[model samples]
Target: MTGRTGLEAVRIQHVLPYDPRQPGGVQTHTYALSRALSDVGHDSTIFAPSRPLRVSLGGTRADLALHPLDALALRRFLRLPHDLLHIQEPLLPAVGPLALLHPSPVPTVVTLHSAEVVAHRFYRWTAPLTRRLMRRADALICASPISHQTAVPAISYEPRIIYPCLDLAAFSAVTRNPEPNTILFVGRDEPRKGLTLLLRAIRQLPQAKLVIAGPVRHSTRQLADGRTTFLGPIPHEEIPLLMKSATCAAFPASGGEALGLVLIESMAAGVPLVASDIPGYRIATNNGDAALLSPPNDPDALAQNLLRLLDDAQLRERLANRGREAANRFDSHVIARQHLDLYQSLVPA
Candidate 1:
């Protein structure tokens, strides 16, 4: 694939187990990276299920709709024409085993983005098969150090660390003045995400209003009073504006977060952060330098941190400015080149 000065333009296919129509970090990352590659003269396509709700993360939609794993679907995926096969979530039994059963005709790359706890539980039954498939990949990537640690024991080769990248310029160009006392919370209402704790914290700070931007699943706690408003699944394109309008972005995940993509968006938008002190959040925010760290599952600590950011103007500005500068390292162009270089390395020298 190497040319005189750089690698020649080639087609790449990304296989995803879930639908991109739903709002998710992995889907958003895959779509954004595909757009970045297109800007650099490379063609990228996604193979995922076609849900009724069609959505695009500011890029081309999935080229082909993948079906449930079976002999038919497996054969269909194997016949696609491409220079490389990129698997987003590598441990899914439905699609991952195909890479091992019949090795792809071209190079294959796998990216692992889950925490150790979740990955272990999901792959416990088919550990050996998953390990073998991971080993067979030409390149392995983990989005964070915690992800790398979680995936190392499954494969023989060391995985490269690549943080999830975003279009920082888009978020930076947004010039909307933030609304005071408006705290934005994104992501689904999972137990690990600490939405319950956030509600309790909000109760302590009666003056602040919390704007929830995602779907809530099985959250019986009703806090939709005058203090909370649920926007109900904001589009991927509008996330930058939502971030820019918030006084502070909160991701109070108690556990099981590999890399908080919302934290990156908050930083890129120059919005101060209030995240839980979990390993994934620590690695994502550089050990609390970029965000205000609160104890996991503690409403009092979360409330205190939120109040601190809301109370002090200098502290918010300082953290926001630092986060903006730190976000440049995870820009879309920088990460696209990294993947391009890795793809070129897999070919013969």
Candidate 2:
């Protein structure tokens, strides 16, 4: 049955390497894309291990850790009836490798979401196998140009660029009630996420009140003083409100970002942004036109950018307006239509 797009509805199975319940970009992308597809009358089902096994790398969770049993189960499930399969992070162990290597009857599309593919130990260790499995995909997509550049050398193929989708309406609906001199930061407690760097930056801005969302380590929690508030791991639905409450948002990721979805979310919420000037972030903010950018790992630069946004209301207004315009490009419905077109191209009429 055809829906609004005038194309037959397709059954799409999305395979995620990590637990969907976990708050992460891949999870959010899958959920948003699936919902958007469903809105246009497509059938979308998400599959992942009920409980993912965790591995720590440099004191942070390694998302690519192998789950052999889970991979085997996912491999078996791939045989089930489906019009198409959309696999995220196809090099990620166990779901990714097993799913990609599985001889499914349906067309498979794999999306590369990591910018640090060349540097990741797991990707390096399984390079040969990854190269082989990648060839089996019917189509390939990269979240951003940085991801494309990092993946092409390893996989030997250029993938079409497709930015991650977000629920722009929900974020746009948030009532803007910015608190004076308030800065909001949302990320997991990882070194790559640069929470420590943001903290150091906050030290330089004495009048800034920082609001942090997402999980935090005890040692890191100890660092928060009267000026900082930790609202650990809030529900995804509440992010819009949290974003709207701030005068501006900061994403100080040091490295290893494929696409900074938070940057897009901040833009959608019509909040001014101060983010690290990295490849992935640069793409998300349209070469830093939508936000103020600073050098990664430089606390002074980040602090200075944050202070500038706080002090200049006119600059904040201009960035927020530009951000909302940039964010419209990632609206879920628009991305869903692109996926629908890709699915149609793969499926026989």
Candidate 3:
């Protein structure tokens, strides 16, 4: 009950480190939630780390763009708020949020979105520290059930599941008509995302074209067959159009994802998906039969799956129909309402 009047009385503040130019999944997720909440007559500000040159967009008036924090900066910064503070994290590499959580007046909720935490390889030492941070939260929201299950066993807290969302309507509307021979991939081009495998798969895929619309961290030279077009780091907004235009959106993650947001996005666009057979995709798609799920890290299998979808029409329609239905649960409006309900439940009546 601060900042604005009337329906805006129950204001909430969410702190995110969003850079418009290099926005990641967390930035997209947080901004979409804030926008959706605003549509439903709730007021919230996304306190992002300062933009490189202070770029302003239309929806920014309702959100705050804060500078990146030092030790002193965070101490002073966390002091101000609308109601509760929602921290979006992959978790800090060195120090956890204990410094902020210990004396903070605002009730905090954190949406955990890290594969490393579950994999237990990177920063294994911080397992205890991460759990401690979870205990301090007034509430916790996870991007997927896999993340929830991973974090739940390691920590004392049990977070609620709120899958990373997509603009379902936008995706659905965009994919009414499609292009032939165009394929899409929307993830970091690391070995983990199986870009290598995808590239290998593409070698066997004759005449079809693939556009890798993400960063290529490793040697792209090896994967550089004549048929592949590597358009590095396309904007998030532009991805839907790309997916819609494509014959199918591709994801072949080797390790795993908490949720396959891109898969659902492709599904929303009515693009058939060729993804890995992981628990995360299984959960996100609800086994919707929209995607061609195959074994992890297998280029041959990946290629075959993609080929199958491309060759067949009835299979594609089956996937498109089922994916459209399954993707409804992740609309920004519905997701924001779920978080709002959780917030209301957590706050004292």
Candidate 4:
């Protein structure tokens, strides 16, 4: 079979460490990338644990848990047939490391996803093992320059930087009907996610109504009032509508991000953004060009940026236009083509 580019189609096996049911960046990337590859006339299958149910996207679910038995299941799956094996977050335990360590039947490409992995003491202790596992990969790719830099110290090799892909067509199709003074925040309920800071910032904006998405912790739930609405753990298909309904989106993560996918999603939806000024977010926003940036963990600064967007409709319009333009670079088709080119290079024509 040949793809649209007139090259022989390649069969790719994507290995994700986390469960697809839990909404996160890496899981979303795997689903979007696989769908994109399929759209471009390639065979892409995802292999991951089946916690409650398998992902709706075409793939086989394994009953393997995070134990030694996972290697046995992976060994059996590897024998099924594939031209290339793409493992996400190879430094993670159990499946990711096991797959990288074990001999593979095909060329392997490993994507490093976390920027904070190197800072952990566990990574330091297992640096030698991680380095050996990484050497087995035929190609190494990082989702962002921040991830590339973080991997160099541990792996002793530079990885090619590729921005994470998004379904731009879906977001672009969404109708923009921004609610007046409406602010949206999407992420887990972790402290590093800066939901606390966003809550504090909302306190200063009396007229602003905040919408919280994803899992909200019990402690954070108590803080929600009549002004806040929590739509917890929405389906991926509903994200475009959620993004379109917002006046502006806010991502206030204090740290621990490789590249914020929400920033790209917000931009693709043509919603104005006010995100943290961190290394990961800076890469996503093109150094604060596409969105308003404020110092991380500073509620006062975050509030000021949100206020500016709320008060001035002209500024919001300008940022929304710039954001849509910036999001074009990370379109799914473009990123899928890059991956296909890499796979073609590794495999035969």
> Which numbered prediction scores highest in TM-score against the true structure?
2
Winner of 1 and 2 under lDDT: 2
Model 3 misplacement above 4 A:
1-9, 17-20, 51-77, 94-99, 117-124
Error of 3 at 253 (Å): 0.8
TM-score of 2: 0.94
Top model by lDDT, which number?
2
84-139 in candidate 1: lDDT tens per residue?
88888766544555644565678888898776465655455566866776777888
**Residue-level error in angstroms, candidate 1, position 28:** 1.1
lDDT of 2 by residue, 7-86 (tens): 89898999988777778788888899999999888889888776578766445575542666776677667767789999
User: Model 1 scores what on Cα lDDT?
Assistant: 0.77
Better of 1 and 3 by lDDT: 1
Tens-place lDDT per residue, model 3, 1-349, is 4322233345677766445356456666788788887777777776554433333322121122343443344455556655677777635331126333647666777877654333444335567766766677787777877776656544675677888766566677784566676778887765567888888888888968888887775576566678788788787777777776787778898754777777777778788788899888887777736678989988889989989988887888898888887788788888987887777666554
Model 3 residue 79 lDDT?
Answer: 65
lDDT of each structure?
0.77, 0.85, 0.69, 0.83
User: In model 2, which regions exceed 4 Å deviation?
Assistant: 57-76, 117-125
Q: Estimate the TM-score of every prediction.
A: 0.89, 0.94, 0.85, 0.93
Measured over all alpha carbons after superposition, the RMSD of each candidate to the real structure, in angstroms, is 4.6, 2.0, 5.8, 4.3
Error of 2 at 265 (Å): 0.8
